[model samples]
Target: MATLNLGILAHVDAGKTSLTERLLYAAGVIDELGSVDAGSTRTDTLELERRRGITIKSAVVSFPLRGTTVNLIDTPGHPDFIAEVERVLGVLDGAVLVISAVEGVQAQTRVLARTLHRLRIPTLIFVNKVDRAGARFHELLDEVGARVSPALVPMSRVDGLGTRDAAVTERVDLLRLADHDDAVLAALVEERTPPPVRAHDDVHPVFFGSAITGAGIDALIGGIVDLLPTGRAPGRGGTVFKVDRGPAGERIAYLRMFDGVLRVRDTVGEDRVTGIRVFTDGGTQPRAELTAGQIGTVRGLGHVRIGDTIGVRDAKAQQAQFAPPSLETAVLASRRAELHAALAELAEQDPLINLRQDDERREVYVSLYGEVQKEVIQATLAEQYGLDVSFRETTTLHIERPAGAGAAVEYNKVAPNPFLATVGLRVGPGDGVSFQLAVEPGSMPAAFFVAVEQTVRETLRQGLRGWPVPDCAVTMTHSGYSARQSHAHAVFDKSMSSTAGDFRNLTPLVLMAALRDAGTVVHEPIHAFTAEVPADTVPAVLPLLARLGAIPLATGAHGIDGEIPAAKVHELRRRLPGLTRGEGVLESVFDHYAPVRGKPPVRERTGPDPLDRKEYLLRVVNRRLTPSQSST
Candidate 1:
């Protein structure tokens, strides 16, 4: 049988998990639907997810829909967890964008749509919860068209049963957005377009109704089966997004196959394939072949990295550069001692974490997520690695920039020995925000050049004010090394020791925290949400939304039958339950990050402790060392 892999995405609490459950039930994969609130959802099996009632990780499940085996990946809605989404997106055939009918377009919805547009992935919009009160179908449809794309067209409409609390009684019609291709356009105008051509059009289609009522699920499922592309041919392939270690210590790499067929133990030239697994709404099952356009996990090849492509021998020829995990936070032990080795191991797993040492201060720095992820790291150490550890409060991840165009560093002599390697390197802003350090060798040995590069990378970790440096170009010229030095230990120590003085005068600036594209503010994550409440609570709820910077999109009697007012709020409101008179429920996901509004009240940091203070002074002194001008 052929396979199809797609993603289901939406804002948090937008019923994305709920809809996944309903889809599984509707397809007969599950005996009954599971509820997110009840913590019984099939995909949200993580302890953190079940406790919080939110998806923290992406999940892949397979089901038979319209004679096709569909692998659906459900992703987390929180912005903090977007890395999970980005990793999963690398391997999907297409996407199902779930937009809440009541809440409409939100900050997260906009961010995600822009990401989709950038990738040019084909999309289908599902406006869920149509049976709920105050569900604005046409107005929200217009919002989707205006904000996301001009191509979204409705596939089905809901007709009300009556003014009473009657359920959604009828589906008026199923429509498809007109195709963009000229051949189809000409055929449609001349009445020559085939029926199947009209049915499986490339235009974006929108389906509406409640996942609870099963009002329009059949048509929605039919459109997905009909429209989503299937890769039946061989030679198509994709890169692995995220890798997980199973209970038996096997590494399973989740893959999105774009253009080829993959089978268990199939060797594509040098690379070998072994353990292969496919997950379904039912459960995980072993598979022999995962052809093009399908998503699944491959195992046994422990050497594979997250972004590696599997198929042809020269896989890199067909692969695109993947942005490795950038967002990071440090997980530190309460005591300052175990910091070094702990960081080394962390770097092995996530090299992007950029773990480095502050020799002067006798401390270490590591990049990581928020407090919760930090806790996980500490726990992982104690539970898995048998190390007891406590953590400190999390801080913003910052990078360093050059104060000006470039700074020159010359390395000449070592501390105890007369050994010398003279060099000149100019450091400036490079292509991206990440700094570039180069060593143009004059007479340095190959091993010495390699050592210098590694040393420079470590020293570049934090600048004068202590922030990781960003994109800076480096040029190495006029350098000579001692033949007596056999390894990196000597060269690494000498290079870093010499560059200390120049780094001080060169002056480094801190690159402020910001999001890509949408200029960043020290924005905290907000959950765009909706709630159903008794009309009397409107007076109370209105004030709460305004206080939290949440904008209300729609509020009125939903067609779900009742006087209950369905209202939408844009930002987080933990106190919402108290304001509503036990009548309404909420749906929300992480919105975009925003600037920390207003003058952040200032606070002074207590100077480093005695040991840290002593270390800082040594760092200051080291910055003064300079090789004589005549050394070159």
Candidate 2:
């Protein structure tokens, strides 16, 4: 049997989840359709998700459509959890982008559309909620062409739209199809059945329906069966896209098989698959093997990770880079021991949260997308870990860039350098964290040289000014090491020979000194925005934008385009509804960062304070050694 690995994506409240449930019912996978409002949806299994009435993580289910098995992945729509959607995109054979006819195209809808297009994943557009009052199919259709993609081809039309009796008909717009392709126009002119259009990521076929009433879903199903292409596998491996815990709390990895077969007891890398589960009839069933083009859960892969290639050493999995967390908060709890470990486990599931700790402040910090996610974290900690916590004021994460070029050196037995190693380093502005060596690789033991280079990169994580220093290059200008020598006892004493530890401790002092001379500038995250408001309220919104540190470069048709500090985006969104009487809308994507205008706030030191030589010496080396003590 063939397979269609499909992704259901939409903006929040756009009814993608409803569509997933509707698909299952249509396929006879469930007895009756589940309601999103009642918190009884089949795809949404989490208690938190059921209470919130939203998808917090992506869920996978399968149902047979015609002769093909459609593995549907229902993903979160809220931008707060967009990271979930992002992980599912690259592994999908196709996608269904859901939009409500009443709401038309939204910011997140546009984002998902563009990402799908960029990844070249064939897609179909579903304009849902036609029964809802104020639903405008024609207007929304036009809006989709203007904002989302012009390659959209309407495959069906609605009758009695915006009413309970609304129905979908088998309809195709020949004129629009002709405009998209020359052969279609020629075929129409010749008075013949036009060439069939194949599904392509560049050309989307639109279907109008209401997932709630199941109106027009049959026509949409036809599109899924006919228009979308079934992918073929090349090798015997796959990429792990999503992960969930089994009933026994063991790892269940969702693998998208691009080719070949994976059977129970088969080993992927170092770990063996002890069990296999395949989705069927709306739930999972034990399967001995998973074939190509299927999404299956493999158990007992003790060391599986998202994006890891299984069975093949070189299986290609496209990595989609989504927006990094822009906000962070200090999490404080009475049970400090449990708090850190729980947060660390959560970080394992979503590494973009960038969890870190501050020993000085005795606080744990987690990166966030917005307040809703923070609330989710707080509730999860209380409910799952039984730990109550509070958060400090939310702040924007910043980065530090090298301001100039500088160099520093620490010689063996040099005063203030207690280690028996000589290391010299140079720092300069560059793209990404990079390291180069001017000294020969054979100048010292490979381990000692490696320790110096590794330490240099790690120390840069907390730069001289506290913010992480990315997009910089460092070079080992000089390197020397003491050979292992027999002292009084003829034993391998670290003091007699330079060790990797010596290089590790000494590199930070040298790197920080070089970074100090090089200088650094804090750069704030900026978001480029396109906003629309009521024409009458444009005057009121312009000054408000300025007040929030926005630079509106262009204004036309009551719309503005420019950049705003990411720190102010949340505030702008809050006031937009009231200022525009709920008619305001904005779309913001991460743009180039800019230097802050004023003094930047410093983060509490989580690592060694290399600026304070005495404190640094005590922390790194455990004690300050005098020149006499260092003498051979």
Candidate 3:
């Protein structure tokens, strides 16, 4: 049977989980429908998700449609869990974007739609909640066209007058089909096969449905089978998008195979897969082999990470573009010793959590998406690890860049210079963080040159500000090696004196001197936000926006769109509802990093100041410096 990997995405509370339950039920995979409000949904398996009535992580379920096996990934709609959504996007063949009929297009809905369009994932729009009162089909359709895309073609329309009994019927309007692709237009002219709604940039087919009553579900399922593209035959590669622990504490790697069959005991990278399992309605079933376009979990790959490609050791895994966490809070624990180990376990699940420790202050810090995420982390630690923990006050995570170009040199011949390697480095601003090793042709052996370049890149991780250097470039301007040493009788020694470790040890001093000479400028993260409210609330919200250093992009009767510092978003979330009498909706995503217009707020230094030569050299020479001392 052909396989299709379909993803269900939406804004929060848009009946996304309901639609998934309905799809499984209609396919005979489930006997009864599970309710999201009752926390009985198959996709939401977490206790926290059950209590909060929200999806905190992405879940997978599978069912048969026609002769095809459909693997569905129900992604979290809440913006706080966007990282989860991002990881799934890289593996989907197509996506179903759910928009509530009553609410029409929302902030997160637009975000998801734009990302889908940018990623060029062929998408279908499901206008759900047609059973709710005050749901307007035509008006909502118009809103979708204006807000989402003008390329949407309605494949079905609402047949009932009221939402309570609304039904969907196939009624393709010929007049509305003109703006679609040539393949679709030609199919209409020939009156042969219906134009294929391909998974591409153009022509998103819209379907109206009430997932609660299972109305219009048949059409949606049929559309997925007919409209969505199937995966190519298995090749020799795939990507690992999720990592979890098995019931027996073994590592599990959830992978989406792009090509090639993966078998039990097959070696991927350095680790061998001990087992493979595919998802079923009831749970997982053991499978010895997974083919192309299939999503399955593999065990015994302990060193594998999310986004790692299996079966191909040299191929590069596509990096997921996720919004950086804007908030930072210190992690406090009752059992201080076990704190680091517990955090390492949590970081394995979501690398974005970014756990850091400060030896000077003896404190731990974690990066978070928002306050709610912070609460979830606390709850997770308590519930899963039995570790009681709380967070310190939240703060903005800032980054810095080089203020100017500079260079430095370390001479091995100098007295007490530490080793036999001589290195020189130059630093300057670049598009982003990058490194290159350049030298006069045959300045040194390739082995020594490679070692110097690798050491330089690793050392550049932290800059003068003690934060990971951003928008900077480093180059190896020069390198040197000592000639073969001779004994007192003029007999040559067999072993070479220079090593990669020597360059690594001397790298900090030279790189630090270069950075200190260049100086630094800090940049703060900014967020583009949209606030929806009643007309009367606009005036009250504008001042609050101004107070938060927001720059308005557009203002209308019902809402305002603007950009603000990400640091202020948590505050806006707290104040907007009160100002608009609990009727306002606010959503923000990381926009860009901009130079601080005034005196930048002081940040806690994560490492020794490179400009302070004495303190930095002493720490590096004494081996007191650690790799984790720098914040990224």
Estimate the TM-score of every prediction. 0.66, 0.90, 0.90
Selected candidate, larger lDDT, 1 vs 2: 2
Poorly placed runs, candidate 2 (over 4 Å): 177-195, 232-236, 260-263, 266-270, 311-318, 403-416, 420-457, 473-480, 486-490, 528-532, 553-562, 582-592, 611-613, 625-632
The full ranking of all candidates by lDDT, starting with the best, is 2, 3, 1
For residues 157-195, could you state the per-residue lDDT of candidate 2 as single tens digits? 989989999998978886766777888889999999987
lDDT of 3 at 626: 37
lDDT of 1 by residue, 503-614 (tens): 3221211111111111212223333454556777777876666665566767754201111111123122346567775555654443333333464222111222111323
CA lDDT for candidate 1: 0.57
The sequence of per-residue lDDT tens digits that candidate 3 reaches over residues 381-443 is 898888999888998877778889989887875543555788888999997667677777487
Least lDDT summed over 10 consecutive residues: which range in candidate 2?
Answer: 312-321
- TM-score (C-alpha, index-matched) for candidate 1: 0.66
Candidates 2 and 3 compared by lDDT, better number: 2
Candidate lDDT values, in order? 0.57, 0.84, 0.79
